[model samples]
Target: MDDQQFRQLLNRFGFSWSGYRKVRKGVKKRITKHMNALGCYNITTYLAELDKSDEVRKKCELLLTVSISRFFRDREFWKSLEKKYLPDLIDKNIEKINVWSAGCACGDEVYSFKIVWDCLRNSLGHLPKLEVIATDINPVYLEKACAGIYSSSSLKEVTEELQSTYFIKKKGKKRFEVNALLKKDVIWKTHHLLSDPPESKFDIIFLRNNVLTYYEDLLKKKAFRKILDSLAPYGFLIIGSHESLPFEPKDLIAIAPHSFVFRKEAE
Candidate 1:
């Protein structure tokens, strides 16, 4: 598809072009693959087919929503959470913790959080009720996440200690499967950030790379507002290192220097 046609397709699905320019080549390649799979000889035919079939259009949307993810993606971010944030949160709410991994692709981030929690719990000599909710817009990703198996490349950031502790090497395969204990507490579901309101107050919400960086200003703000609404008093919000809030919401305070971590001010 040409630039205009691709942009039109994305626009129809409520995606903006803020960061589309940089990823245009990759997006076009994906579109071409989808078109070929659908037996369309040209962009014109594909567009016509896309207009007629909801299933095809949904597949196109999934293709455009890139699902690149890895465990402990920005290592420093997780370190900051372990050494700085979690301690304070634990002090305040020692009995329970609620964490939401927004845009959690294939379960890496969710499992990462559990690994950190396991270490912290061992050090503290107490176990709190940890409820982790991982959500993504794509059903295929959710399915993969539920399986809890990952390629070696996706586990690169995971330390040797963590890998040995939490994952078992798949027999005769170059992949790792998360241990049953780690997977037990996590709840995976399909969710859209823009339209769905928060189901419950969360102690910490990880709204990293994709949701904030990929969309336009208006949608970003809308999603941000919903995120803020979901955070409990004195709760934390984590975003991608390269991401910034579209507009600062009132009473949200940055917790560290040059960090995407912020805490909701208690009313």
Candidate 2:
């Protein structure tokens, strides 16, 4: 598929052209294969198939998805999460801390958070319970996440100490699997961020590198509002380090030392 055909597909899904432009070549290759499978010779026929068949459209959306993540992506953010934010939440004396790793592709960020939480137990005894809801739009990714195995490259950002503590290397393989201990109590589900949140407030919601990165303004703003609303008062909303909020929200305050970390204003 050429750029024009790719743009048509992005428009059909309300996806951002700029967002897909950089990665469209790979995405188009996948879509083109899908089109050939359906015997669609051109964009027009593929578009028609998408319109009439819910199954085809769903598959197409999965093709359009871009999941490029690693453990402890953006080192500063994880440092802040561990040294500052998690500690502050602990000091609040809340008995339970709820976390939502939205668009949690392949569970890297979710497991990374769990590892940090586990580390805190070493320094601070008797910490509150952590409830993590990890969601992604693609069930295929969720399935892999459930398996808790990751490529060596995905663990590049992880320190040697962390690697020794949390992951067990597969025998003679470059991949590592998260310890079963870290996988427990994580809720993994297939979810579209454009829809309502998981019917629960969050102490910290990791909304990094998906919606704000790949959606058009209208969809981005709408989804951003939903994510914001689901954050409990004073709860944190962490976006991609390079991403900007679609609009200046009145109730969100940027945390010091990091522009990407925002705390919901107390109601």
Candidate 3:
């Protein structure tokens, strides 16, 4: 299909321009397959066919969903969260702590947070009431995440200590199983970042690599504002090392190097 029609088709599914470019590379094949299944030849005809049928819409969504992830993909970021942010947060409140792992593909990052919390809890003797909300727009990935089974490839960045402590060796394979205790603290749900209201304010919001890069400047600003608004006083916002919010609000204090941590300055 032409660029305009292609853009509109993807936009209808909540994808942005950057998203279209990132996905268009591999997606053309899937689009062709879906088109073949629907007996259409081009993206224009394929989208038209999909709009006419709910089954085709579902098929298209399944084809378009992206789920690339790994445990502790940025090792230093997790270390900083554990050593600096979590301790600071723990010191502030022992009763409640909320962490949101936005765009948590296959729940690796959610489990990573749980692992960090468990380590701190062991050393601290008592821990805050910790809750990790893991969200993704893809229902299929959310289901796999909730199932808590992962391939060894997904755990490449997981440290040896964590592998030994939090995962049991699966029989006859390179994969390790996620501990059940960590799973208890994490809640997986399908959430559309652009359309859905922030369900609750979080003490730490991990809106990592993928979602930040998939929008124009205006949408990026809106996303940053929304994420900031959902953060509590002294809350943390961690993005990919390369991705940054368009404008830094005065309220958000930079945490050196790359990260930004904010304290609520006004209601």
Candidate 4:
């Protein structure tokens, strides 16, 4: 589709310009493939077909959702979480600690947190009840994540020690399957950040890279408000290292220097 037509289509779905820009090239490729499958030779026909078919529209939405991610994608951020954040959070909460890994693509981020928590638990000699909720809008991603299998590349940041402890090498393959222990407390679901309400109160919300980076100002604000409301007092909100809040919530304050981690001010 042409730029104007594409923009109009995305606007209809409440997707912002920033989100469109991030995935424009990939969207175009997906659309062209779909158009060919539908035997449509032009953007006009394709748009008309998309308007009429719920399946086609859903496919487009999946195409636009950014899913690029890896296990422990940013080394330093995980270090900060394990060495600094988790210790403090564990000390403060006596009940089950709830963690929501929003937009958890292919489950790497969720598993990453479990690995860190497991390591910390070993040293502390005590552990809180832990429950992890991993959500994504894309069911395909959710399916893959549920399988808990990954290529060696996706595990690049995982140390040899961790890999040996937490993953099983597929006997004759390069892929690794996450150990069953790590999957015990994780719950996965399909959710849209803007349209869906918060699932539950969370001590830590990994609201990274996706919505905040792709959404326009208005949607970002709305999503941020929802996230803030779901956060427990003094809860942590972690965004991508490169991302910043479009407008900070009154109760959420940045906690770590040069990091996107924030803490909800306790009342």
- Top-lDDT candidate index: 2
Q: For candidate 1, lDDT tens digit of each residue in 25-65?
A: 89889888888888997767887897999989878878888
TM-score of 4: 0.92
Q: Which residue ranges in model 4 land beyond 4 Å of their true spot?
A: 1-8, 16-23
Better of 2 and 4 by lDDT: 2
- Candidate 2 per-residue lDDT over residues 114-207, each given as its tens digit: 9989988887877888899999999999999999999999999999999999999999989999999999889999999999999999999999
Ranking by TM-score: 2, 4, 1, 3
TM-score of 2: 0.98
Q: Candidate 4, after superposition: displacement of residue 264 in Å?
A: 0.2
Candidates 1 and 3 compared by lDDT, better number: 1
lDDT of each: 0.86, 0.93, 0.76, 0.86
TM-score of each: 0.91, 0.98, 0.86, 0.92
lDDT of 4: 0.86
User: Model 4, poorest ten-residue lDDT window?
Assistant: 13-22
Q: Number of clashes in every candidate structure?
A: 0, 0, 2, 0
Report how far off residue 93 is in candidate 1 (Å): 2.9
- The pairs that clash in candidate 1 are none
List, residue by residue over 1-267, the lDDT tens digit for candidate 4.
778867776676667776567678888778778779899888778778879999988887787787888999878889888889888888886578999999998999999999999999898878899999999999999999999999999999999999999999998999999999999999999998887555678999998888887777778888888877899987999999888887867888888563599998888
For candidate 2, give the lDDT: 0.93
lDDT of 4 at 173: 92
Clashing pairs in 2: none
